[model samples]
Target: DARRTPPAETEALLTEEGLGAEFVPARLGGRLTRADLLARALRPVFRRDVALGFGHGIISLFAAGAVWAQGDARQRQEMAGLLLGGGRATILHHELAHANAILRHEFTARQSPDGYRVGGRKDVIINARRAGLQVVYARTEPARGPRSHSVLLLDPARQDTAHLRHLPRVETSGMRGALFSGLEFTDCPVPADALVGSPGDGVGLALRAFQVNRSLICGVVTAAAGTVLHSAVRAATEDRAGPVARRWHKPLAGVFADLLACDAMATVVLRALSLLPASAHVLAAAVKYVVPDLLRENLEELATVLGARGHDHASPEYGALDKLVRDLPVAGLGHAGSASCQAVLVPQLRGLAERSWFVEQEPPPQLFAPRAELPDLDYSLLGIAGGGDFMAASLVASADRTAALRGPGAHLGALAGAFATELRTLREQCRRIPPGAAALNDPAVVRLSDRYARVAGAAAVLGTWEGQDGTDPFLTDPAWAVLALTRTGQRLNIPVPQLPDGVQDTVLGELLRRHREGRSCDLDALAYTP
Candidate 1:
């Protein structure tokens, strides 16, 4: 069962729903438009099954994103037509070990008079055997720099089968419902027009494409974590006198707050793709780096709350948690791992430390407003590095506003002030990291990047709470924000004061209310039918 694809009926249902159109842009004869909305639309599928979510069409989306981002008019139109017709597409990179950091491409594409001869093997590709379209990363030049690689769009159905071989499917511990396989190209020739972007723009195109994919992925995976938390809460309520149940109150509230925090960051980052493209890459990397770790920790805690039932795969009630626990790690390491994300932030921290942190203007409130209308996603605007630390600036701005509040909400001001101070401390540490040592190989730089990511996450929570338009009572309430920041502070090793009276009870009450009402634990609080 762990080595199989999603059930045939599930695949049929997804196809019937025209889910493949979600990958193609609206202008290109499909329904895809906003990045945040795309993630929201995919949540129901992910909430029920992460494997189904990916195995169905997200792999095609991932492969087609490059085409959408950099493909020529003909290429984009052709790719869009394929996706619109419910055909599958998959991406193939040289190796998974160096995700997004294309150090070298083992898959070679030698130049020919009429076309390029692609030859090499790409392993661990998702949906390799079934996809009709393939987007491959290849070394087009013999040199060893950023401009030596290229991406090629290929149609395997038209290729000569003699030179193209599909390797054996890979068996993995998680997301087994998704196919993972390899492709070996023996002098397979693709037309010269198959090139995406340009001859040496592979690295840039890949990075830009990843910025969108990474942000949306961070938002999508939260549904899985939300499901796990809901299950744990249900189990705890049924057996309140169990050993772990007695102490589940705080942890349950904490996980709920963490989920909200992750959603806040993810929403803002996804919106930034269209609203603030210059800084979106860094924000995306930060969310990608921090959210998974938080969700993984939340899952571990929920597992403990469920006790032995968490591992009981035969129990209809708790069996889903066991599968989710296995799938969350694979999701985290999918497009880019934690270290790769941190590596993105490390080199950019010094620039922000010197000129941006306190100096940059806070991002537009629209960046934090989940329902705000956004401009169309412009792939041309996404930069490799951020302009400044606008999210961090928002933290400082929120602290200033919180200081003006009086009465019970005054404690939140103090919490906000503490995070503002933490940002200042982080800026100094980042300033000290030598420019030459900002690479991932430097442990000190990596640690600094981690700290920066946490601070940025705290900033996102503050911005979201402030951006609420009094429409959602829970989101407008500062109690969850207080708990969210306190949890973040604890992670950063800051000595924080105890929560004010009734704060835990308030958050716990809302958590239970949502469960009893069959609502999701995320910020959306959408009703779910069981």
Candidate 2:
């Protein structure tokens, strides 16, 4: 109804509500101590409106992430104050051809007697026109090398008006309210203080920030999918005993299981950001590459139940589903695409295979808890390389525990044994890959990365189920777990037996129960008015 209203006002409202503090560091008088907690708070906004969510503060968080990772104490303090004061920020890191490939960046910040003369154009930056501060990654050296690039924190207000320009907003199929525009800087002078970290550390800092951004993307995608799923359920159950409700039993139940699995992956990865910072980067990429894909698939399945209401903007109550479908795909292309994230995991596969992946000890149970208090995110501890896969190891451990079950849990035990065999297959495939940077582009390598991601997601689901410790009645049951594993196995192309009839009925029943109660199918346990 208010599509004509710009995102600027909505952003201001969120700021007035003190959401800006959520992006600032706790040391700077904010509550950004944990990524998962912040994600929980932001999920509702993304669920409501994708454009407003990104335009409001997610763009600022992207800019703040880089500064938080590489900026000095003074720089971090200044950014925190700016955000705390309700000012917006944006990051300029990609151009037309080299979108997010920092190594091939054409932007330059040449040294001058005054400071640095920045010249380059950044395309499709979110909140470009309204941002008070812009974090730009530019090459400081004439030579072509990774060390040549550096990050600069520029105050657009201070730039020369004659040399700085913001291109017109780029219209899109969705999220049209965003101020998407290109930024052109021609010999724009920036002070020495604008430089973030050392001249050669820009790429490293950006990669570290990607770890945080990717995991956050998983959370937002899960939330958006949850909103759509809720609408689908309402549409299906509006006539509780009608054919629509009866016809969607199995399909809707399967979709709910996929939602839960994706949520589990998002939760584990977000918690890993604080628990195992070094390994978190690899896991983050896997979460980024896998969870969005799963959510996309789940949304497509829900569309069958939703029918025309998914595309019709005139429908009361469920019209927002149309916009969400358009907005979710953009998350896949932003910051890093699926292929790029998979590339991040390729080079490290061999090491993970031989050293610690499937053989490692189980990760702490708290890592899978949806409402657990996590430690503060330490940017310095985020590393590009990973030595182990704790989540996958947890799956291996759970399979052993389930194998000893005697009663109804025996069904889950059989499924776990099958998944363990799949893990062994993943291990052998990883071992066959020759370790080298040149092999990153191999089709086989890409396929392996994709499979590895599904395996990781399966492990996350297993860990979450076990982590509940029979406290949550719904999660402790093995029916949903069986469905989650089956869905994962389907994605991995691993042949698993059909779900038992009893398990199927139980899983389907839970799906209907959650829908009628106005609760999300994801692990967050959030309740909303349907």
TM-scores for every candidate against the unseen true structure: 0.95, 0.93
* Tens digit of per-residue lDDT, candidate 1, span 1-530: 35366678878888888898998888997888888888888888888777777777677877887788789999898888887887888888753321332223368899999999999886667778888888988889889888988999999888989889998987766777887777889998889999998899888877887788778777888887888788888888874553334478888999999998998889888888889987788988899889888887888788877788887867767767788877765554443578678768888988899999899998888988867888988776788875787898899999999989887678788888988988898889878777764266888788888888998998899899988999988788899999998999899898676788888778888988898898887788999864
Per-candidate RMSD vs. true structure?
2.4, 2.6
Q: Model 2, range 1-530, lDDT digits (tens) per residue? A: 23634666666678789988999988879879888877888888877777777778677888888789879988898888888988888888753111233223357898888779999876567778888898887888778666877889988888898888887766665666666667788888889889999887777888888888878877766777777877887788685665445678767888888888877888788889898887887788888888767776777788888898887887756776777667765544443577778778898787788888666888887787656667899787788776577867887898899889877677777777777887788788889898677778699888888888888788888788877866678888877888889878877778777777877678777767777787766776678754
RMSD of 2: 2.6
lDDT of 2 at 12: 67
Candidate 1 — what's its lDDT?
0.82
lDDT of each: 0.82, 0.77
In model 1, residue pairs whose N, Cα or C atoms come closer than 3 Å (at least 3 residues apart or on different chains), thus clashing, are none
Candidate 2's C-alpha lDDT? Answer: 0.77
Off by over 4 Å in 2: 1-9, 95-106, 142-145, 240-244, 333-336, 370-372
How many angstroms is residue 22 displaced in model 1 relative to the true structure, after the best TM-score fit? 1.2
Which stretch of 10 consecutive residues in model 2 shows the poorest summed lDDT? 95-104
On lDDT, the leading prediction is 1
